[model samples]
Target: MFLGKVVGSVWATQKEVGMEHLKLLLVQPIHADGTDAGTQVICADRIGAGQGETVIVSRGSSARILISKDSPVDAVVVGIVDSFEYCKE
Candidate 1:
């Protein structure tokens, strides 16, 4: 799993059969301290996460399994993050 923020959305007029109904979002991964970690990623939204909301993401086969065993999704927004605790050193 990874922590990220929903930065944007993706609109696809046409897509694979199983992917058509999924809401795609652009997420910017962030560290627990809330700093940008790297480049943004496109994720399938399952929790109705909106832009600017913190979210939890799952990648690879784990993400695919949420939709179906044969789902082609590589990443998914599995949960909307309510809060987090990060220990500072």
Candidate 2:
């Protein structure tokens, strides 16, 4: 898993059979210090995360199995971070 910020939402007019109940968000990967680390990614959200919220993301097969066995999801929002203290050393 990794840290990220929910930058936006992805809306699809039509979705796959098991995906209709999920919401997608555009997440910008962030470092532990909360700075952008890489390109944005569309992530499956099941915990109602919103824009600008700090979130924890899990990727690949582990994430896919959590949502569905046959989902095409490569990334998913696992948690909404409540708060954190960054101590840069």
lDDT of each: 0.93, 0.94
Residue 72, candidate 2: how far off, in angstroms?
0.7
Global lDDT for candidate 2? 0.94
Evaluate model 1: give its TM-score: 0.95
Report the number of the highest-lDDT candidate: 2
In model 2, the clashing pairs are none
**Tens digit of per-residue lDDT, candidate 2, span 10-84:** 999799878988899999999988888999999999899999999999999999999999998889999999998
Estimated TM-score for each candidate: 0.95, 0.94
Q: Mark the regions of model 1 whose C-alpha exceeds 4 Å error after superposition.
A: none
